[model samples]
Target: MTVSPSLSLAQRLRLWVSRPAGPPAKAVQFDRALTPWAFLVPQLAIVVIFFYWPSAQAVTSSFYLEDPFGFGATFVGLDNYADLSRSNEYRQIAGFTAFFSAVVTALALGLGLLLAVKADKVIRAAGPYKTALISVYAIAPPVAALIGMMLFDLHIGPATQFAALFGYDLRVGIDYWDTAFALIVISVWKQVPYNFIFFLSGLQSVPVSVREAALIDARSGWRRFVDVTLPLLAPTAFFLLIINVTYALFDTFGIIDVIVKDKPANNPMTLVYKVYLDGFKGNDIGGSSAQSVVLMVLVAVLTVVQFRLLERRVHYG
Candidate 1:
């Protein structure tokens, strides 16, 4: 590697320039096939074990008659589903489910969007408003239910006392509609924060110039919102509709458990709760599995229908 002292400075410079950059600095290759997969193994295993395995077992168990004890299982073809098809109670449960899901989705999305709009309009101290709103989301389902329970407890609840002040008795458990209202309140309470976050994010994405232009050209604020802002929010609204439906179906399990004093009563039972009531509580494993399968189908169908039908109307901003 020694250079000749006899060579001129220009010659030395030329020689140095002519030398290669030493094996291209061993260009690092990130094309390893196994590294990405090595990272994904744990997640894949967890999904398979927790989600797919149980789903498969539920499907399999739905097709057979399982003994109360874990040992004996007999293939019952479609009898469990057949019994469900003929049951008047199952039909009523389905009806209640449809109504409850629709109401929850509407209340959650509507109130959330309204709250988000008001929050968006706030010119001062928005942090406190958002924090207060989101604190409800952090409340655990059982805890939230318990709080609602205490608030509406028949004998010693502030809510009942507040109603008494208005000359109306608001008993939580003793009245069917009152109980229904409480469940709806809890369901809506849990969903509003989630919907608020999404809707606020959506609203913030709308350009201020668009709002300004709408306001300048349109006669009124309501007209501008209807023509411009609401259309742009259609996609967000539609997305939330799907989530709210799924939440109504499945995610309200704990809320229902804590809120309903009478599980056997028809007032507050959804399909998800019915599955638990039948399977774990009643030990009708086969029938409950079938019911679970039916619920799974219903949810899948509902999602598909909403996406297909509503996506056509959505305006992506």
Candidate 2:
């Protein structure tokens, strides 16, 4: 390629930056071997400090019962995990966590996909519509929880009043299942916009020529979508599946914290929140560390399974 002599330096620089990348070479050599390390070191340092170091510390702590006040620690090998296994409350919370994660992930993904498909087809006021749909995502989880609390408030909340019309009392914090319902609704609502943004982008990235071909081949709209459009979306769907699961597991901490008002008595809560309550509030440092290690292992295994099993079905276009 030849540069235009008339072009300004800034314009030339922008052109170079925006130039399309070429196919990979079979073999390439760097002038300096340390050059790669120069670029990688900063990211490696961050990962080591933020992730691996903490993970190591948690594993160490999990094997010992530490004083909450940092007075001392007793080496109690595997007792923390054993306690978790034997405790009925821990088991119950674990069960709830699984159910909550599944429900929230499903709802968030399904609704987001549906909305994205609709938004992609919109011909009028698309900008405002997309903006309105995604605006909910900008709100913090705690704020969303606060909003949910007000909406589900027993006396003056619209949702509560609406439920009353059907002769059903919607007591959010007071009733276990009602609180779980509120938590799930708010969590799903918060997550849907993120999934929508990704799904919309994925839909838009589908080749127009491919879409035309699918249209010509399939007489039924649903058939065309299921056979062509859906397969094309498999990669995005799989990516979102992992993300949604992680979000449901860990990112809903603030939402649960705000809604439960720091009192987790008989209310539905996930494992991440349980770790917080145990470590910070209950001051069971060792137990919480054990829980954290458990979560880390669980997430890691889940990710591996997703890559191994789910990726087989994902046909990357």
Candidate 3:
């Protein structure tokens, strides 16, 4: 193709960019084929060492009853799995884990979106407002749980003291339901900033022209948001839904550990934490390995379902 004689440099550049018919090109090439493998070896080694190795060992260990002190093992076949299937405590913990994950993901995503919308509308002191909101996420999960413990510390905690005004006693770390409430609150608080950052970025990425069209088409702000903004944000929302579910399942271990304070006897715990407790504290390696395998399957199934079914409604622009 030939450029017009009158075309400016910027117009010429645009024409070049728009001309898309071409084979793919590689930017970098290695003199030897082994060079590419050399570059990949480190990352591949790390994945094998950290992920695949442990997974294989866990699968092997699950079928055997081994001494906690590194002694000989007896093959137990499916006994460990059978024990988990029949345990009432394991069923209760599974129920709590499902409830906890659902509640935390919902509250975190909802509050994050709400805050992002409000922050997007702020013209003055936006930096400080966002900084204040985002700083909470920088605190580690265990640290957040520690702060939560203090807030519900029964005697001098402001939250605990405030409960006295309503003639209600707040007994966190003691009462099962109260401790669960604290766990949910801390988990949501720890996760909201991450969700907020994503939601705010998604909101900001809406084209100004699209916003103007939406405004003209729908006079009501809520209607415009529901009809226009939400569809555009669907991809981001779907991605965050997966991330938040995984976070609730695995990343909240520190928070639960700190809240329970090494004593999970009377407190609510997630399945992941129960694995650690049984493995390390109770010295039941075979059972913990079996539990870990079950969790791995559960997570895999959940991910497949999310991708296969839940992703149907996500419309990416």
Candidate 4:
């Protein structure tokens, strides 16, 4: 109670020194840490507005039956989905879509890996090979489709003439199965080149020392590739696998639409094509939206499965 002024002043100074400065202990350099957000905000907004907003609209639209003008859509609950399930066309389309995606993915990946491996060995002409391969990929899908149709279509298509030269009348137009196969061929041709680029990059990224070590260990070419190269390329393969599958499902629609619009019986008319036909030709917006939702769900499930199962095995540097 009778403290000296000097002692009191010293105690006050100690308390002032102990006190936290400014606002409650903020993060160190808060402004600097958050500065990246200024740059990120525009991209984030774009993604939300264009990608997420449209996806949300598509999902929402699936539950409603829209008027012809799309101004007023009446909520239909699950009727559109129910109809899709009951329809034979939808079942056929789904089956074809699954088959086409699976076949094309496998073919593209296999061929791409092969091509990439061969190209990797070519120290002299690697650039030319890559250029030729990627050039096909750079062409517009519609243009590719048109060219594919011209090459394979029944009447005046060269594929038919080539078949004749081999004493086989390969009429793609008349034969549903042949047409389906042609679609597969076209799909594989267009995608294999694109997939090759990724595979090539992955191959190139593999350490030369590891490969040399494998060779020194008396590993044959096939064994070395199987044991070492494949393991190293697992991540790239998995990535391309998912991407190629998605492309086969979605982007290949343009080619399929061009070639098989009239031939509904052909197996190339996949789920996306069904959605397009439903929305535009059949004028069934709700049904198309439901089909799209189903396709989206399928893709989502596949993507999740890829991450869950394949991610552990992938070797990323």
Best by TM-score: 3
Which residue pairs of candidate 2 clash? none
Model 1: how far residue 7 lies from native, Å: 72
Q: Mind giving the per-residue lDDT tens digits that candidate 1 earns over 118-237?
A: 887883756787888889888877888898898888888888899999999886776767887888988898889988987887888888898788878998878877898899988777
Residue-pair clashes per prediction, in order, are 0, 0, 0, 0
Per-residue accuracy of model 2 over 221-270 as CA lDDT, tens digit each:
88987998899998888778877877888889999998888568989999
Per-model CA lDDT versus the true structure: 0.81, 0.86, 0.86, 0.79
lDDT agreement of model 3 with the native: 0.86
Q: What shift in Å separates residue 281 of candidate 2 from its native position after superposition?
A: 0.7
Give the distance in Å from residue 283's predicted Cα in candidate 2 to where it truly belongs: 0.7
| Total colliding residue pairs, candidate 2 | 0
Ranking by TM-score: 3, 2, 1, 4
Model 4 C-alpha lDDT per residue in residues 6-118, reported as the tens digit of each score: 22222333355557675656566455777879989999999999999988887888999988776888999998889988998778777877888899999999999999999
- Preferred candidate (lDDT higher): 1 or 4: 1
Candidate 2, after superposition: displacement of residue 85 in Å? 1.0
* Candidate 3 segments whose C-alpha is farther than 4 A from its true place: 1-28
Candidate 3 lowest-lDDT run of ten: 1-10
Give TM-scores for every candidate, taking all chains together and pairing residue i with residue i.
0.85, 0.86, 0.89, 0.81
Which candidate, 2 or 4, has the higher lDDT? 2
